[model samples]
Target: MNTAAFSSLPLNPALLENIASLGYTHLTPIQAETLPPILEGKDVIAQAKTGSGKTAAFGIGVLSRLEFNRFNVQALVICPTRELADQVCKEIRRLARFTQNVKVLSLCGGVPFGPQLGSLEHGVHIVVGTPGRLQEHLRKRSLRLNHLKVLVLDEADRMLDMGFEEAISDVISYAPTHRQTLLFSATYADPIREISKKFQFKPITVSIDSSHHDSVIGQHFYQVDKARRMSALGYLLAYHRPESTVVFCNTKRECQDIASTLDNCGFSVQALHGDLEQKHRDQVLVRFANKSCSVLVATDVAARGLDIKELQAVINYELPWDPEIYVHRIGRTGRAGKLGLALSLCTEAELPRVKAIEDYQGVAAKWDEVAPFPMAYAERFQPPMVTLWIDGGRKNKLRPGDILGALTGDAGLAGSAIGKIDIFDDHAYVAVSQDSVDEALAWLKRGKIKGRSFMVRKSQWG
Candidate 1:
């Protein structure tokens, strides 16, 4: 038997079958190295990047030790952002599909508290959530982890960067010290070490090389004048014309300014930063992920927990002070054995940062000159999809299938015309091909979804 195969692990037969059903024949490097210790019910600290199958590794461990009969929360996975928390919950649910009556809930802020409270009342075996909301529930006595068997701090470095150390410590204080603890982070910085020393008991450290290989991600740096930064960015976008790209900025203001400039220049763009309202943030993220938006301008802090698949390129409008952050930013792209592009613009003042990155990666910086491009080239770039927002969502018992059926069956549109359909609590968003937007919107307005009329309109970004 191949040691890299999932069957090599001591997993339940049903779980093995389910893993196979999910098309996971072999364990990812992170999973293969950490699953043994995780299954053995031991404390493990694994340093792995996003999209490394870490979620499945921890999700499997949580489910393997879950007590289905018991209503108490047996496993708690703390994440840095609500987006990440929701993603973790979804992955865990998929992993637990083999087992019946295994409850999993996501308790994140930016949504109604009453619903979370109600879910807690009904009982859940696994809870994946952020720090603030979890702290609120713990304070209200609506959530209790006295029976927690396994505790996981997913993206521990991001959590610490978001200043959730106190809340994480507080949440851990509620859990039993005798239980197993697992910490996963992309970078094992000093703070990460401190977190492990403070919480984990003699944790088995597992570090996977988080660095990107030169063969995988093509790194290019262009020297630009500070005043011509916006022009440089536009030239890059016009040059590459990536269908999906993320432009990483170093500040919230810069993030917004770059997004606005690109939007004015006729590119489908949105900004993600700490200052945006939660609803706006959701819209920005949904539009970007669904391909309705082409380029996403975001600060590192705001880009935490972003897991976009098949991202073509990553642009650093301004280099981060830390090389690890550069690695984390570029790591978002070139995932799953796909080619990735990392482009950077550095001014004379920032050349030192370039040297730092080169020294850290142990590779020379590849320099490229940005040739002038016609301004009209920017106008030619547009997203292939347009998103429509429906007034009703999960709260009104709406689902993706209902939206799809309405478009295909009643709207007389082919299924291929529709892209990704995302259903939220009070609203839903569906991506329609650019050619089908008008028809889809017109039909959605006159027609009914699930036999109920809904206000529908094309979503727009500022």
Candidate 2:
């Protein structure tokens, strides 16, 4: 089941080693079925849910076609969101870990264009990005598509659902005429099939978990009054006190309201919706994924490619119109060899939707009563100990170790005194204990990391 097993599938020894280093001994169903055709240079259409190992499925094939010495963009993976682009690029980088000079760039909107243009100018071998920004780069001549060998449209249906058809088609039209077109999605409706027909040439199709069966997740039903659903959610959180949880609402506004209510109740919580600035959305996700925030309230679209490893539970604050969304939401948990809990707060009016989910799963949910939420019966908002902002990150060759060394060395602060450190593409965020905020700031102002100075400032969480 190791990379050695896949060695006969026409991959190099270095790639095999890289796969081993990534702790992937054997391929998942998606990888096993899709890798061979892709490695044989055939176009593939793969359907798999999140965390089903599709990233590595296509990543290996893309990396196998690359020549380390060449700097041209050989493979272009277009993801629907910036977060997804970043995630895909990270996976590609890992698959190409042993190879020297494998430069993977993620181009997305809301990030600084200047840096991306500069990176493109320097040269890149693989590019992963969102449709709009990729098209923008192509128009500006910053991203050339002539050398493209493989074109991957990840989350293809989501792109169509999000109305990225024009942007995706535009980017595709610019790519070379004879390139491999690979499309990956959770479901392949007529729209995706039509796009495949238009763009892909007799591609091989691989479907895993087509029924969207979710067995690992423990389903629980919480019956509450229409007005007291929020109270029931609060009670469940206090009762279970899961390490991390995502509460899904039917609308963006409901997500905001729930997050605000939780924050007011003294919980480390954040809301992810379409209305927030991209930067804030990124920060909210980082906080929730890193356990800096205990709860994340989000709409389905905003929560779509979120892969939190230790996610303990999922709460259906509002029932989705499509019962399939119920399966996708709960599937986020009960992953990576851990048990997951899926709870739904249902009112009398939503009985049909609730029944649909239960019938689909072929299992009945255990009903529960209104238990006491030993939760924070607290009053109002309290300011955090200290907010951190780092103006330098991966592009600047900055890392957590360097930041830690700088803070402890130049700032003369104890390691335990630092609260949290969240690193992004061009910036990082660190939190210092309230007691040492003044000293940390005063010292960092004069200190340097890797002999280079960066702008460090307090964060505005509100």
Candidate 3:
């Protein structure tokens, strides 16, 4: 039997069928290495990058050992960010499709606390959340881990980087000491090893190479005068004009400044930083993910846990101090068998950082010169899609299919004119092609979704 096949694992028949239905025939390297130990109920620490099927490996393990009959929290997944927590919850729910009653809930900050308390009151089988929020719930006695058989620290390094080490320890204090603990991180740094020593029992360690290949990601370094950095960025944007781009800034202030400058330069752009309210962060992420925004300026911490598919480019406005961070930033693009572009702007002071990166990757830096491009070229930089915000969502029983049906039916828009449709608890965002924005918006405002009226309007940033 091929060990790479999902069927080779000792999974429940229903789960095997669901995995096949979901089109996962073979295991990713990370999954193949980690799942066996995970399913065997052993403590494991795995090093793997994002988009590497790490979630499925852990999700399947959690589900396989789940006690659906008992409503208590049997498994806990701690993430660094709310976006990541929500994403993990969704993926686990999809994996749990084999059993509809396997309850999973997200407990993250930046949202209402009352709802989380209410969900806890009702009970859940699995809880995926940020460390801070989970610690809070544990403190309030609203959440208990006495029944937790499995505990997973997803992106453990990122959680530690976000200063959640103390909080993570606090949450762990409440869990059963003998339970299985799984730690997954992109980089196995010294701190990660320390945490593993402190928290995990004797564990199996699995590592997958996290390096990006030159053939997949084309990297270019441009030397610029310290004062001319913004112009160089504008030149790069105008010269390449990728459909979707993420500009990585080293600081929150720089992230906001670059986003404001790009927006002022007539580029559809948004900034993601720690300072923004959660609602604004959601809007920015939605616009960028739905292709309603062309450029996203974000700090590394702010951009953590962002899973954007088909990202065309990643630009480092300023080089990070660590080569590992550089590798992580550029790794966001050039995924899924598509060519990825990584452009970096460097000054005389930043050459050492570039050298650090070169030594880390074992490849010489590819240098390029930046020249001013015609400002008129920016006219073509407008995003191809426009997003419409609907004030009704899961709370109102509104779904993506309802919104899509309304637009394509009464709105008379072609299916191709519709883009990504995202539904939240109390609101939703639908992306329509720029040419069909007016038509979609008009129909959404005049017509009804699921036979009920909704407050619909064009997103301000769209």
Candidate 4:
């Protein structure tokens, strides 16, 4: 019952103003309970799911204590994937906006090291990165953490699941022992506790569940023969027609097969797995997040740290052996007060596993029959947006505003026609309404951005 307002806390005036401007009046449970300890520079282990305002809890703490004048690394936030790292970096930057000369950099894999090295050479205040890339930089002596005052491990459980224990250990070894450490994860498993014991010093624990799972997300299980599992999945998709869906497969091969089948069947689909090159992986994630792809087929490992906002549904093609993962899978949807749907296809052999899930959740599973397969001539499912790849990006000083101006100003397209715009080191991806993709592409190819012409092409997604 600690219903306290954020103004009650001793936060910087500018930060308080920023929070208010962002429409946050009161403190979330996680922010109320954890921000105090975090701001006090005490070690903490917080158990909060995605979209629980955990980022701001930690972001506010780090930004408040930042030494902008020093210009050295003051905070280090390690994430499980490049996507999550980018997201954390963005949130932290947003929180630090009112604070002048505060620089936040994200260092992750999938991009070249030369640029990262270059940025490190220039110096930054906070560093958000993945274990692998950070470890590489540590080994090369390109990144130094001696001045590090705060160390936050966001999504600690997902990092462990991705097999980054050794990398995390090595990276932590480089950080000074006197720094404040914050470990935040959705689950408090034994391994997480072990890590907290080893690295944290008498840390306080906080767990909050803002999402009432069963109430917000409708869950259903359908039993089908192993041979008809794909058919059942397609039938479920056709029936639900979720604008954006994530289908989880147990194996990489299955992930690819299902994506291929769906693509062939005229569903806009993309497959994500460890086998994909970094370039392809980035494209897949961008397309899905921007609504250019209706379905994303992914393995557990590849889908780790995926935080897709407004995700309509989650389809569990195969359940994981651990019930905890099952919780995490369905948790992707039903976020941000949105109603979600979770459909699972199980065969006879997997019935026992289904029971385990039911027992874990402490609720009897609801059984449902899949809708009959759609007719051959049925309207095909297509995503509302289409992605266009532009060759220029951060290196060329490209900004979302620049692209937006070109599209809406010269192309004469409405501002609403533009979707998510992501700028990388050397390339940028912009999502436009499918109705305006051709015009946007043509305009970009013909128009100059920032007084320079860069190649523009449509991204081909299966």
RMSD of each: 1.6, 3.5, 1.7, 1.8
Tens-digit lDDT string for candidate 2 (373-457): 6446463323234567778988798888888888888788898877657677789887676677788887777778899878888
For TM-score, candidate 1 versus 4, the one ahead is: 1
Best by lDDT: 1
Query: What are the runs in model 4 whose C-alpha is more than 4 Å off?
Result: 1-3, 210-212, 374-379
Candidate achieving higher lDDT, 2 or 4: 4
Q: Quote the positional error of residue 221 for candidate 3 in Å.
A: 1.1
Per-prediction tally of clashes: 0, 1, 0, 0
lDDT of 1 by residue, 1-462 (tens): 124999998998998999999999998989988999999999999999999999999999999998799998999999999999989998988888898889999999998899899999998999999999999999999999999999999999999998999999998998888999999999999999999999999899999988888777999999999987888888999889898999998888889888887887788899999999999999998999989999999989899999998799999999999999999999998888889999999999999999999899898999999976444434578898999999999889999999999999988999999999999888999999999999999988999999999999999954
Give, for candidate 2, the lowest lDDT window spanning 10 residues: 377-386
RMSD after Cα superposition, model 3: 1.7
- The local distance difference test score of each candidate is 0.92, 0.82, 0.91, 0.89
The RMSD (Cα, Å) of candidate 2 is: 3.5
Off by over 4 Å in 3: 1-3, 374-378
Candidate 3 clashes between residue pairs 3 or more apart in a chain or in different chains? none
